[model samples]
Each structure stands twice: as structure tokens, then as C-alpha cells.
Target: MKPIYSRIVATGGYLPERILSNRDLEQMVETSDAWIFARTGIRSRHIAAPGEKTVDMAEAAARQALADAGLNAADLDLIIVATTTPDQIFPSTACLLQARLGNRGAPAFDIQAVCTGFIYALATADRFIRSGGARHALVVGVESMSHIVDWTDRGTCILFGDGAGAVVLSAGDQPGIISTHIHADGAYADLLQVPGGETRIAMQGNAVFRVAVRTLGEIVQETLAANALTPAEIDWLVPHQANIRIIEATADKLGLPMERVVTTVEHHGNTSAASVPLALDEAARRGCFQPRQRLLLEAFGGGFTWGSALLRWG
Candidate 1:
């Protein structure tokens, strides 16, 4: 028999104080805000305070998610952090977050799937919950991409921002995750990837843009068909906040109108791993996601990783 898992009880997000607008980038580089906004739909993005690390932002978001779920750190059984830019090369940022959150016993680790991170982490948490290894899991998608971008390169620097978002998943027998689909085409890995220093970002913008649109549409159709659902049954469609064009293409291919797509790219920019969860939390807070609401979430990023999940919020 297939094991059953629970619903995500609560969601929360935390953004840094510094807001870097495309205008700000224009002053620093050769690009204009209009070009950036027209292409990516990103006007501004947040930057972590001096000395703030990925773990710090993850902890803050996790705390809020816990509070929203009416649970505490002591109650958590697992913590999974989805990030490409971790606080360090070792010790895993998820473990650091667990230590900081006052949860000494929970098993914590980090996953590096670039932008599709939250969906990857969510699936991991769901499996653990299903297998009866964990009762409550904290899944956080945090990134400090601002610290790593080559600010001198207008092509990449103007496209990313930093932030974190978290969700608290608890055990239940309701329809939470109906179906999930994950895909990767490593042949295009170099299309958009940070090449070195374990810090700096390296990317080929044009090529990655084309692949993202194609893969997102294909995987979304596969996910919907597997779940026995149709585009009309979806209450909301949330795509990775990489670029507005990417989101629009994905929505169009799925036959969903732009109005039905939840977007925060105009305000948050491409927050990488944090984008999806941050959008979800913001929508949940605004009362957009009702109980039993069907939401389809998708993301694509470095590693050429992409994933989709169909869920009915419990």
C-alpha cells in the first residue's frame, strides 16, 4: 500500500530590508530598468543585510511558518532547505538553521537543485511524512544570490535577488499532494549556472530562456494528466519567478489565462529557490488559497532542473 502524507499546515516568507531596483542596477551597470522590466517583469528585489546569511533568513521564515501552524521548533521532526547558495560549503545550511531554531534533534540537510528547489524540498518532505519517518517537516527555500552575482555583468546581475520562504507540513490523511513530476536535461546545464568560487554566478541568458519555456510546458501537461485533472480544475498556477516571459509562456501553453497565474516577479524578482514558496505564502496570506483549492506549482532553474506539483490545500 502507498503511504499517505499530510497537508502543509502553514506558510510564511521573509525578505531582506534592502530593495535593489532595476534603476539601481542601471546606475551600477549598462542596462536600463525598462529593458530589465520588459524582459523579466522585475522592477525591484531584496538584498540581505550586511553579515546576514542564508541560514539566518531561513530560520526567520521557519519561525513564522511554525507560528502560523500553531507549532513550535520542539515539535519539528525534519528540516529541509532548498538552496544553491548555502551559508558554507559544509555543515549544510538546513542543519545550521535547525541549530539556530532551537531544534537540536531534528534531522536537517540541504538540497541544491537551483530554482526548482522548493518543489524538490516539498517532495522530499512529503515522502518522509508518507513513510512515517517524520510527523512535521520544515521546508525552506532560501538564497542569497545577490552576494554571488557578478555585478559588473549586466546580463546576469540585474536578474536575481535574495530572500527566503518556508512552509510547515504536518501529517494528515487529506488530499495534500495529489501528484508531482520532476525532470532535468543536464545537457543544457551550462546554459544558466554559476561556474565557480562556490559563489559567483555564470550564465548564458538567451539559451536558458528557450529551454525553460519548453520544459515547463511539457512537464506541466504530464503532471496534470497524471492527476486526472484539467487546466480548468486548477484554482491557481504558480511558476518559478525567473522571468515574466517564461511565466507567460507556461501559462499560455497550459491554456490558463494570465489572471489565474500568481505572480510576484514584478516585486520580488527572480529569488531563485525562494520564489515559489514566497509567492505561495503571499497568496495564502491574501486569502487567495481556500481550503481544498487546487494549486499547480512549477519551477525551472540551474541544473536545468524543473518540477511540478498538484495539490489541494488542506
Candidate 2:
């Protein structure tokens, strides 16, 4: 008998219909389009409309992923949603998504690692499959960051958008999820966070940028070393879309050129936990990835949490 491995079968993503451009921010706050593009490489981002909840986006993405995999909600043995801005406090977003999917029995829950949430949730779901506890799993990363942004604060307001991304994983007997690495430092939490009980997002931009670049570079190396793989072996880099500079820095550390990275920051802004999966789905849909290709996914987010995952595309 071969060891069970978790492999991504399909991917999907959804961004709200409303497009909020930097010029729109100029009307709402005191920021210029040129300034925003120069700093974050974000020209526009999708904004969830009023009454559009995080679970709503998650459900939509999940349904698409399920369809793409030629499976249904009933086939899933587990559902894990990675989110920071859920629809409610009591019911986890995963639970809501499960109900929407008409899935009643399998375990469901949520994980909050900010922008690193997707990577963490993917790692968790991989373990369940490998442990024989789950055969099929749904992993989603969704965010309504626009709901938490302080419209009055130009710095933070210009950095976030709303969207969701999802993937279906199933047990297999091949190389799929090779390795996942996650790390966090609570001491740097305040560098980028929304205080408890507060709706507004805050961040020490310069401080977070310095830490993100250094830590992200280090973790990519750690993941590569652990897997006994080198940068040249990686076919695609689906990185967290927080900042172009940070993404470029990580690619540089991996000795990968910008063309090898899947980037969407210019249009999606930073969708927190949704960034990684969103980029992945987009790249996969564009026919950019091939079966058995080596892929590296990584993210650094508030917690100050950070992680990396190495996998073979299937």
C-alpha cells in the first residue's frame, strides 16, 4: 500500500463586482493614484458590496472549485476556511460555508493567520488526508478587508480589497503536497493588525515592510532546504499579494525571475488570507501550470505569521 498524499484537484476564485480604483480613493481620502501605484503596485481592487459577507464569497469560490474538480459538496470529508473577517463571531465561516454547500456531517472550522491563513489551512487539511481521517477536503481563503479598512486613513485604506479563493484536495498515491512550513512571532503583531473589538485596520507600514522582506526570504530558503529542492526546480511561485516589492524580494531570494511568479497585486490589492489562493487559481486557470510541475507557495501576514509550501501540481 502506498502512503496517502493530498493533492489539489481544482482551484477557483471570486472577486466582488465593484472595482475600487486609486482615483476612487482620491475622492474618499487624500491619496494619489501615482503614489499608491508607486508604493504598492495596486491600481485597483475589488470591493464587496454592502450585504456581501465573507462566507458568501467563500461559498461561491467553493462551489466553483467543487465543480472544477467534478465533485460535489457531498464528497467532502472536511471543510476549512481561512479568514479574519468572518460574517459573524459565533459561527465560523467554515460552518456557514458547509451549510451553504449542504454538507452536514464532515468536520468544519476556521483558521485565522491573517494573510497566511490559506497556507496554514492547506497544511492542516494535508495532514488530515495523510492521517487517513479525510479523503476529500475543501480549503478556502476569503476576506472582506474593505469592511475593516479605515476609509479615512489613506495609508491602510489604499492597501486592501475583498475576494475569496478555494481549492479541492483529495487523497492520492503520488507526490502532491511535498512539504509545508509555518512560523509566527507574536511580538511583531502590532506591526500589522486590527486591534481586538475594532473594525479598522492599522499598520506600521515601514516596519512591517522591513520585517516581511527579511522573514519571507528566510522561510523560502528553509522550505527549500527541508524538501531537498533548489530554486531552479520550482516551476511557479504563487506568493501572497501584499506588495510587489516583497514579492520581488522573495523571488530574488529564490533566484526566480519576476516572470516565474504569479502576481495579481496590480489588480487585487492585498486580500489578506485570500491572496495566495487567488493568485494560484488565476495562474492555474490561465494554463500557466502543468501537471507534475513543481510549485512553491508562500505568505507573510499579521500574527506576524509567515509560511511556505512546496508541492507538485496535479
**Best-performing candidate as measured by lDDT:** 2
lDDT of 2 by residue, 1-314 (tens): 78999999999999999999999999999889999999999999999999999999999999999999999889999999999999899689999999999998999999999999999999999999999999999999999998889999998999999999999999999969999999999999788888888999889999999999999999888988898888899999999999999999999999998999999999999999999999999999999999999999999999899998899999
The Cα local distance difference test for each model comes to 0.89, 0.94
Which lDDT tens digits does candidate 1 get at residues 152-244? 998888888999999998987766877778877788877777666456788888888888888898988899889777878888997889999
Residue 220, model 1: Cα distance from true site in angstroms: 0.6
Model 1 CA lDDT for position 126: 88
Q: After superposition, which runs of candidate 2 have C-alpha atoms over 4 Å from their true positions?
A: none
Model 2 TM: 0.99
TM-score, candidate 1, is 0.97
Lowest-lDDT window of 10 residues in candidate 2?
189-198
Candidate 1 Cα lDDT to native = 0.89
Which residue pairs in candidate 1 have backbone atoms (N, alpha carbon, C) closer than 3 angstroms, thus clashing? 6-172
